[model samples]
Target: METLFWLEDSIVGMTVSSTQWGYPIVLSLHAIGMGTLVGVALMLTIRVLGFAPAIPVTSMAPYWRVALGGFFLNLLSGSALFCGNASELFFNWAFRIKIVLVLVGLALTWWLVQICVKRSDQISPAHRILAALAMVTWLSAIIFGRLIGYWS
Candidate 1:
């Protein structure tokens, strides 16, 4: 656990010490990636929950894959963005809340993927509830994260 945090710290350190434009560029991409991941995830989850019963559930799974790719891209971008301001992020109250919310959002998504998707062998009706919750939580997380930049 400590090693993982250390790795994150190292990445953040590199970005922080890099040129100013580098930070902004990575941050922009991170925001874009977040939008892609969250948007697609919400859409797919909603489809699973029966909101879009006309849509094939398995076909919708592919969108989640696309979302996973965006998530990885965001991981890279987020690393650079954080690396550019490691110390500040570590100290920011809003940033901390944002991180916690992100964790919760991820956990909820994972839970839905396993319980609703795996058990049903397709998206379950329960997915609608999970999707709605995910949207709210993820949107709040992103908004709070953006707010940190503005306030700081």
Candidate 2:
């Protein structure tokens, strides 16, 4: 609690919280990152789940680079966004849920990537499950993230 309050009161937080454009800019970045991350994840997951059998999963390999970039961008922007309201976010149940979902989503995305790298021809049942889980995790994270504002 003390640490969160300290972060909320820190220079970075103050700038984000007080500046008229700062919060919005950071938030917009976060949204862009989210779109990239979730959109690419969904596309890959759909391939793994055998939606578009014509497109080889390996062909989607380049997307992982884009997804990783999005993840890093989200990490940076989300951290700044969190800093702006650390005290409240730290105590928000929805925020915690969002974090967990994102972590799980990341793990699932990793597994999906591994599957793609190994056997892009015919995906196994496990790969399909992981792909489905990834979709659910990402979507749930988005839902929980949206709920954070209402909850806090």
Clash totals, every prediction? 5, 0
Identify the leading candidate in terms of TM-score: 2
Itemize residue pairs with steric clashes in candidate 1. Answer: 12-83, 15-84, 16-83, 16-84, 49-128
Residue-level lDDT of model 1, residues 27-50, one tens digit each, is 778878888888876775666556
lDDT of 2 by residue, 32-61 (tens): 999999999999988888887888788888
lDDT of 2 at 90: 90
Worst 10 residues of 1 by lDDT: 117-126
Q: Would you estimate the TM-scores of all the predictions? A: 0.75, 0.95
Go through the candidates in order and give each one's C-alpha lDDT: 0.71, 0.90
